[model samples]
Target: MKEKIIIIGAGVSGLVAAINLEKAGFNSVILDQSDRVGGRVKTDYREGYQFDHGFQVLLTQYPAAKKYLNYNLLDLVEFDPGSCIFYHQKKYYIGDPSRKLSLLFPTLLAKIGNVADKLKILKLSKALKKKSFDDIFLAPETTTLVYLKEKGFSDEVIKKFFKPFFTGIFLESELTTSSRKFEFVYKMFAEGSAAIPKKGIQAIPNQLAAQLKNTELEFNTSVEHIKANELVLTNGKTLAFDYCIIAAEAWPIIANLKNQESAWKSVENLYFKVKEKVIKKPLIGLIADEAALVNNIHYQPIKKSDNYLLSVSVIKQHNLSKDELINRVEEDLAIYCDIKVDSFVKYFKIKKALPVMHTVNYMMPPSETQLKDRIFLAGDQLSNGSLNAAMLNGESAARAVIAKIKNGFINVN
Candidate 1:
């Protein structure tokens, strides 16, 4: 008989786990608290405008991501990180991509200040992934700034590079997240292509979800509890299973973590539609070292609609009123692209920001978790919090469970 498995959280991780379980010849039931799958990978289309709630880009080189993301069907829009506009003091300054600070400040070049500072970045890149959170928690995650400072990067360079780049990620403008996350992201940015999806970020999770037609998906259902080999439902029913896998976010994990302290992080997203007269091509912007400012802007061009879509991500609280958020970001767009943004038709905000991955606890534990047996923990957070991570981790967790089941089910060779 096929072993019965119960999976929780119909998000990206949950679906991946369910699909992998089916591949291993196990029948599993996937349960989620929300009405849909995709978890943080949400897209809100308002008046033909598209907005991705969390996680916008994926690198083809990401070890785990390359394994699951459909390479045959999904195409990535390459990023021109070589051309980044830095918005500081309400002005947009173009910075050089080859670690040259002189492009931002020529005067510093003559003082041996900029010339010498450039070498520091070149040096750090040489030694990025020597450690990968195997068993070390040396420093407390303050912000990305302190990590940069400790690495010998000057404040000026931090503002021009680290500020807009890293801050936009964690929603903490100052980079107060853990250095481990900081180090890993920097390496990815510097080395990987900042490719957005050709269609949109939703293509990844959406395509992944579509492939799960063979598996049973229970949407809008919540798991109340599990006890004595039975899965309890919010509707007061129970599901009996041979094994259960949890692919929910940290909130659900911590809730069932029992005695352990629950872990959480917060992210914010602001999206808008630009005037027709705005920039023609889509461009991404990274904010300077400013906390109240947005870390980056991802704009999309849709000629069919006569409007352009734009999303502003600010980890920290942004100082923009309803109208102000739209107007200010539009203003910043003008500075970065040299085209006025007031030409667009309309805009809206989807505040479903969340802890995509945060300081301190963004550290992923083993998929098996601290449990004795039977129960397995898996999710995007279980790996490194990406569409690929979720899928790969889910497969691995399912494999681990199936391996144990095979030993008991199969005849000796």
Candidate 2:
């Protein structure tokens, strides 16, 4: 008989774990507290508008993503190569000239940085391209801010370009995230495009969940506790399993097993329906002003119409009410785009947008994946805070379980 595995959380990690286990001829069940898949990568459709839980994009170059996801089926829509920065009451389009020749003059003429700074960007890109993933993560570890300073980036460029750009990606105002993460992300960006599915970001998870051939999924089923080789559900029922994997974020329920507390970064994504597109290009717009509450903006055009859905991200939490926040966002938008507060539609205040990862790694060892004898842990928190990490760790945990099963682990039956 096949081993009965119970995986907690129907997120990316859990789904990937189940997929791998099924390939190994083992059957597994997935339990998720939410009503649908895509734990943090969900999309809600309202009146023909797609609202992703947070402002998210998939770097096409992510190795795990490339291996697992079918991009052609996703029908991705790519963002332009670089960002359109709003700095000092002016808009400047800075792009990668290597990708598109038309962006050459604009990138060179943009005042966000000097010629030397642009040269440094190319230098950094070349340097990172040659370094493998192992080399990047295994090298010295330091704050991103320190790494940039040591690279000789001018204060003007760091403030106007890197600060707003990376702040939106890191979900933190300060560039205190690990330098390893910065280099990894930078290399990914240089290597590929940042894109979204033509349908929505959630489509990525939905695709993965659809591939479960030997797995059963129970939504809205919460696991209250785990004792020995059995799981106690919140409904006062218990189920036995040969192996269990906790794929959710670090929940208090499993706190004793992991013995680690996790800190998270937060963000608020405010969406608006507008009659016209703002910032014209499909590129991301960064607010270079240090005092600005709005971090970045993206105008996703609604299909089969002239209207657009504007996604505005604020990386910090504030005490203002909804009305007050919208008003302030409008004031900030007025500085660069022709937008009005009346266009507001919906907003999501995600308190845990991303996990705060200080020490970063590409992947974790099999020994570290096991929380106990039969209980395993899988999530981005175990490695780095990226979709790739979540997928990598999930597969890693599955391999560990497969190894144990091959070594003559008993069948519960």
The candidate that wins on TM-score is 2
**lDDT by residue (tens digit), candidate 2, 289-333:** 987889999977554265678899998668999899998998888
Residue 210 of candidate 1: its Cα lDDT? Answer: 77
Off by over 4 Å in 2: 255-259, 303-306, 408-413
lDDT of 2 at 237: 89
Give the Cα lDDT of each candidate.
Answer: 0.60, 0.87
- For candidate 2, give the lDDT of residue 151: 97
Give a tens-digit lDDT track for model 1, residues 150-220: 77777777767666666656555656666766666656655566676666677777777777655677887
Error of 1 at 168 (Å): 1.3
State the lDDT at 61 in candidate 1. Answer: 59
Evaluated at residue 153, the lDDT of candidate 1 is: 78
